[model samples]
Target: MDPVRTGGLRVVRAAVVLCVRAAPGTVALSFVMMFVGGVTPVGLAWSTKLLLDGITAGDPAGRNAGVAGLVVLGVLTALLSHVRRYCDQELSRRVKVRTQIELFTAVSAYQGLAEIEDSAFHDRLRIARDASEFAPVQIMSSLLTLASSVITLAGFGYTLLRASPWLAGLVLLSALPTLRAQIRLARRHGEMIVRASPFWRRQAFYAALLLDPRAAKEIRLFGLAGNLRTRMAREIHAGQAEERAQDRETLRVDLGLAAMTSVLSGAALAYLAARIAAGHGTAGDLVVLIAALAATQTALTSAVLDVATTGELITTFGHYIDLTSRARPQPRPVAELAALTGEIAFHDVWFRYAPGQEWVLRGLDLVIPRGRSVALVGENGAGKSTIVKLLCGFYAPVRGRITWDGVDLADIEPLELRRRIRATFQDFMTYELSAADNIEVGDIGGGRGRADLAAAADWAGIGETLAGLPRGYDTLLSRTFSDSAGDGGHEPTPGVVLSGGQWQRLALARAVLRTSADLLILDEPSSGLDVRAEHEIHRRLSELRRGRTSLLISHRLNTVRDADTIVVLRDGVVAERGDHAALMAAGGVYAGLFRLQAAGFADETVPR
Candidate 1:
């Protein structure tokens, strides 16, 4: 089998297994109901003939029994149909939830944290995210319907054979092309969908802008609603057009097939009716044959539809196969990493974001002494943040290994290294969670429970902030789910929002939630704060660094003038390294930027 087809088959089979596993009893119930329901359909067709024969002859003994049998068959079929629907519901619900849980967990485990900047990975993530919803379960249900429909068609054909073998054969032949046409349509539909992936997401983003509180404010301020909607409609139209074109071809093919099936069915009915009129068959037999053939056509059409639909859905999941196959996390050996200390040394380290990209850090050598505060100042895109990521173990060096107290960093376990360190990046996230949960998110292990979050927040300067919230730290940070509608729609209630500086403070607090870490990294920790807040945070940072080593990356030269050591980075290499005064005498990259910043406040204070 071709790879894509094989993958699609595998996905469908896996979904089927999940459906079966979710509610075994329901699966059994569904099978039983379908079998019984099919039997009742056949019985009803036969009973109708018998009832008609007795009525025509006016024989009360046979008439009563035939009428009662017809009624019983009708009631049985209705009850069986109900049971089948209930079972299908149960199976669908369970499979949907379980597939979502697994897909969610799989995406969570997707590796290559360092490759997060890769756009290709983002596209793959998109598929995995869509897969995490209810698609898997829907495909499974479609497949089960296909199977039951096939069984029903077989029963209908068997009943027809008892009346006229030639009629049954002709009906089967006429209906066969319907399945082929549906299969072609499914492939075309799936292809159109995959091609429209980017368009769909873009439409969704523009659509999202109409509803989001923050985006809504700016959009209305700019009077962009009409423009945004107009753009959205264009993309939507393009996608719809692609779909219509695909269906237009299928429509033609299906119409021809449907016409053929109808002609054959009509011809069969006429032939059977003529035979009954010619005294070759009784009226009762004629009615039974007619009903059976009609039911047979319905069952065959249903079977064909289910097969194509389930196949198409399974094909859609193939989009995720490449990403999911390689998404497994890298193994980490922890026992050897437990001996790590804060001493970090980068030796002849070379790095690149991608294979063909320029090296961000080339042949770099640096070190941070244990229990000391140090700063790295560099121009934008000059590999300042890259170094921090390397130290934090988000990425391993392309050429050299980072050492932790002398052991090669790569040899140490990633989890162990991460547990022993924390960092607050310049572009830190402002989580839409409670102020308490926000800070506690820094050290999830310790961030949970009451005492730990409080201690971390108190140390990071979030105590007063939380106390001021409407519901204190328990309040949700989003307005969407906060004021939920009683009927499961939008509640439209707003939640407490925070200032930029306040949010930055909370991010910092979250980062240092685990004070026991051997190393702590602060990258532009005071970026958005006012002078007083900045000074206060610096004071807190200095206090927090006691007995713990730290690396501070900042462009604000004034903040780290008193650092134990200041290194200047330029053009992917360290340009100058020394104490602030020594760097000033050298007048290198760090000194120049520092002096320029000092010139802004020259009259207030001067670095000696």
Candidate 2:
């Protein structure tokens, strides 16, 4: 089989499965209704012919029965039409919900962060997610529509053949040109949509920026609103121009097909009228022939259109399959990791984000001993955060190994390894959730209790501030959502937004909630705090660090002065090692940086 055809079949099969699994009863009923509706037109046409013949024969009883049958078929078709519409809508809703859940689950299953960071992956993900929302429903609807059209076409074609085989054949052949045109148009439209996806994504990004409260200050201060809006409009116009070209071509083809169809139908009707005038066929025969010819044209047109639409839908659905089928990172060994009782050492590790990129960590060797505070100090781009990412198992070393108690980290599952450590990043997220939910996410399994949540908040020095809120622990930490106090009323309360310093404290509280984690890592934990607030938070952190293995990364020399060990990194290599006093005595890079910072606060006397 051709690869494209095989892939399309797979997508169709998957869509069928989704529909059946989502709502089997509704799907079954929809098919039955479609069949009834499809065969009803033939029955109505024959009944009308019988009624006309019976009236001409002067048989009053037979004419009344035919009239009653026509009325019943008309009512039945109307009822089936309404019922089928309802079933289609309900089935679409169910399938959309199920497919979206499955797509997101596949995305979250990826353990490596590299794929998520890639721009190409984001584009594919956008296509996959959008396809999942509508493709399944479209495929099923097209299939049902096709089935109905096929039944109607076969029934009408048989009736037309009984009248005149040559006329039936001509009508069928006339539909070919329209079908061909529609198929070509559909292919062109699908290609255009794929080519324009990136532009659409950029337009969405700029539109989001305009609505984001966080960007409002910078956008106004820098006068960037006009520039951003203009860029967004440019992308929209570019996409629209391509679409308009395709639409113009489609309109031209369709108009040509319509003219051909009209000429063929007019010629066929004239021939049938002459046959009736020659007295070879009755008036009843003329009525039946006209009805069958019109019905056949309508049914064949719909079937062809359904085929074209389904082809486009399947093409879009290919993205969903490609994203879900992407190879995941290599699996780690199933062996259990031992407790972190010994030192965690990186043995001559080398790593880079991509193959051609400059090395972020080159032949780096370091040891973080158990039950001791290790401070990593360096300027920007010193591989400080890279080390944290490796330790957390977000990436593996390209050369050498990182070991916990002589056991290589590669031997343990990333999910399992992360369970024993907790860390806060320099760019920690400010989740738009309730205050309690924010902290609970840090230690999801342990922090469900109110007391545990409060204790963690207190340790980060944000407990008092949280208690002062209207809803305390339940207060929403963002202005994005309406807060409902659940007072059994319809009104919603306004949510509270936190300051940068307070959000930093909440992030710290989240990490502190993980009391069971063997290793605690803090990166720039005090960067957002004022001098007095930083001092208080550090005091609490120092008390909590006793007998715990912790890694602290900060540029402030004073904060790491009390650490058990201080390591300075430079250009992807460790440049200095020892406590603050020892490094100061050696007058190395760390010493120079510390002196430069201390000079900022030194008293200077100017002689006039």
Candidate 3:
């Protein structure tokens, strides 16, 4: 009941199913090829003895017959080898394709994007990815070689036994040392792969930046190609040096073992020759015995190698299973989000990132009524964004009661909760998607049609920017984005690039499209925009603020001075609470920060 034994049986069963389904002829041909290939070496070894005996006895006809048989067997061996290799390659290619398709589906189904960010998981995933994508062909080739080698060695062993039991013993001993050393090295190399996969992934990324066409402009403009190349070269050299050092040690051990095996086999051959000279054995018998010994070594060494490769292949193949298990989709319950009410409340919340950390939100209590705009003005490090993320259901507070219309957030599915909220982050992703698609992505799977796209664009001041696109709303954003819009048979084009401000507006537009959402959040939406653009955005935001509950996180106090409430955050704790006038009179954390800002615009004499 070992798990590996159970899984291996399953894998083998699946492989057999595929093999039988693909080509029944090829499967049968494998056994035929193994048998035919095995007979050739045995035939040649036996014929050598006959040829030598006929020559020694001065029989020209018998010698010619033996020579003719050896020639025929050699031809047969070549043809069988070719047929076996051809069939194995074809079968493996098909299996590889099937494996890759399944891997894609399994990995794509993963909902936990956070797991993909972990180093250990990434390393394991790379191994699975390679095995699913490329290992089928290798496993197939190894299996074929293993089959042919075993059959040939068994046939050769019989001939060796007929000549002398000592010859067969020598053949077995000769391959043991080589097989032991090679197998150890192969296993060690596999271990190295486990350790080196992550490093290699990083190196590959840097190398891609150096070589890829899309990265060429950035590389040249930033003068990063040489630096990246040097960094990657260092990693490659370090890995290669370690492997080479191991290889050198392995080589020394292997050579010493090989030398000892050769001496033992050579001594056995000398004994057989001496027997032939003493008339205990004929010259033909000695010749046949040596040939049989050589064939046995070839086949036995191959079999041992095949076994080692198969072990490594299976070990790596298990990674695919592990990755699949981790990525298994959870069957979450469906909840009604269509008839949502926008009441949100956070009560007595105490939060921390992990068990041992200090609490970020201690006894936090807040509420945003069915439809209203609230502002959280905080100094850096005040847990303002954490509050926004909590509302958006990206993360749950370690200890808190967040209610959606009197229903605790814990009772609702995370995805379903997110569907009722929309937000633009300070560090929002500038996806390499078309201008229109950028907005459409906010309500992804909703398929809200072209009118939704235009509405969102207008709300966020992106319509003016979209008008300047190369294809209006259909120019490819990223250089790597292929011109496949036409091939999709939808629009003439459906991609467009945008500037930084334009991208920010597009992100805003994306948030705007989630019109059905009860709650909306915007974190530092106008941070780096020009003065005119910032004011325009603030003006546009006023229209959006009506009749919808929102939480705005901003350092620009002027924009949120008109909020229903303004809570000051300093050092992850609330320091003050009041409107612009009330906070100015209180003269606490908010008062100091506001005075600092207002003084920047004061005249030199007037400030004092």
Candidate 4:
């Protein structure tokens, strides 16, 4: 099929399917109502002609019956109009909810993190989301409106043809220009929206920064609010300026079309008046001719506009289809992953986030032995977090392989592989959920009980802090909502926000909750804590790491001093590897960083 026809079929199929699934009875009834409503205008016009002829012929009974018929048709049309409006509103609501669910499901089904990291993907995803929000309703509405307008136009077209074929042809031809203009405008509008999506997203981000509580402190401290707001306003103005330019073109086209339509209607009206004045046509014929001409023009305009609008909606809906239909890499069929037994090894690994980008991990060889704590120490941009992502199966190496025991990671299902590993990253999310719920999310498959929750909290040294909250484990951990608001609506209560250290401890507690995982990775887990808190956390972590394979990534050298093995990374390659004592004795990159940090602490202790 032609691509345009294929896309149009897809849009129509989706609209029909959604309408029927959302509210089948309402959709059927809406069609009936709109059909009746469409034909009623011609019926009323004919009745009016009859009434005028009855008066002219001086027949009281004929006039009375015509009057009654016209009144009945008008009332029926109004009734159908109201019922159809109600049905459309209900259909729109249902379609909106259903589309949102499908869109979210499609987004969640994506298996790789690479697309999420790409700005172009973000732009497309944002447009898909926006399109899904209203495209279903717009498509259904436009389709139905087109159907009704076509019916109305056909009915009035026949009446005008019988009165004067020339006038009817002129009216039809005038609609051609309007239709062409509307279609062009619709294409331009869609293109502009796609081009402006990134700017709109940036504007939203800046606006969010002004409102975000986390950014509020920094924004005020640095006096960045004014600058950020100005940038946001500038983006909005730029977007508006683009829209205004499009609107100007649209205005010019519409005005020109309107002039043509006015000329056609005026010529039709003058011809009708001349026929009636010369006794060539009855006043009733003039009335009927005038009504048909006016209705034909109106219906043609509406049908053409509906076609243009539907075309635009179909184009937008194409984005949603494209996103949901994207091919994801299929995980190979393989045996279920077995529990880790010996070690996890990276052999000559080389990887980057995208093709042509600089390698984030290059020819890296490392081993994380079973039942041992291994620490990775590195400077910024040393691929520390990238290693964690690779280990967790978020990305596959562009070259080389990672293996658990003797089994290649590439052969293991990503989901199955993830089932045996857990990690907390430097940029861990603080979910706006209850304290217990946040911790529970870590090991949802484990069926963690109250004892397990408490044990995890205690291990992370956050039990005391959680116990003092307004609702203990059930306390809302975010200020986004009131405490009682999310707890089944018992009563409203103010939510409390945790301190930075407290939030980090909660994150640690979340990781600790996943007790069954064979490998536990902590990437800068204690970075947010104070000196005393960091010491206590590492001490607790040391106890937790006793017989489990774990990887620790941290800048603070002291925290990793007790690790069985320490690997220092530099420029995407392993620079050195040994126990803390051996690395320090070697006086390499690790030793230099340790000495620098030690010097800062030593100066602080000199009675400042």
- For 109-154, candidate 1 gives per-residue lDDT tens digits of 6433644665545554565457535556667656656666676677
lDDT of 2 by residue, 1-608 (tens): 11134387887888788889999999899888778878888888878878898899887876887798799998998888788878878988898788788777778778778878987667667777788888887888788888888898888899788778998899998878788888888888877777777788889999999989889899999999999999999999988988899889988988888888888889998998998899967777788788888888888888888888888877777777766655443567744566789999999999999999999998999999999999999999999999999999888999989998888898888877888899888999988888999889998876269998999898888999999998898888878788876775636777899999999999999998877788999999999999999999888878877688999999998888888999999999899999989999999999999999989878676679
Instruction: State model 2's lDDT.
Output: 0.86
After the best TM-score superposition of candidate 4, give how far the Cα of residue 337 lies from its true spot, in angstroms.
2.3
List ranges where model 3 is wrong by over 4 Å. Answer: 1-114, 173-180, 208-230, 271-291, 314-317, 331-339, 347-363, 390-396, 401-412, 480-497, 576-586, 602-608
TM-scores of the candidates are 0.90, 0.94, 0.79, 0.93
Residue 11, candidate 4: Cα error in Å is 3.1
Query: Predictions ranked by TM-score, top down?
Result: 2, 4, 1, 3
Worst ten in a row by lDDT for model 4: 1-10
lDDT of 4 by residue, 532-596 (tens): 98989989889988788999999999999999999999989999999988998999999999999
Off by over 4 Å in 4: 1-6, 59-61, 327-331, 406-408, 486-490, 602-608
What C-alpha lDDT values do all the predictions have? 0.76, 0.86, 0.74, 0.85
Clashing pairs in 1: 483-491
Give the per-residue Cα lDDT of candidate 2 at 226: 98
What TM-score would you give candidate 2 relative to the actual structure? 0.94
Error of 2 at 499 (Å): 1.0
CA deviation > 4 Å runs, candidate 2? 1-6, 325-331, 488-490, 603-608
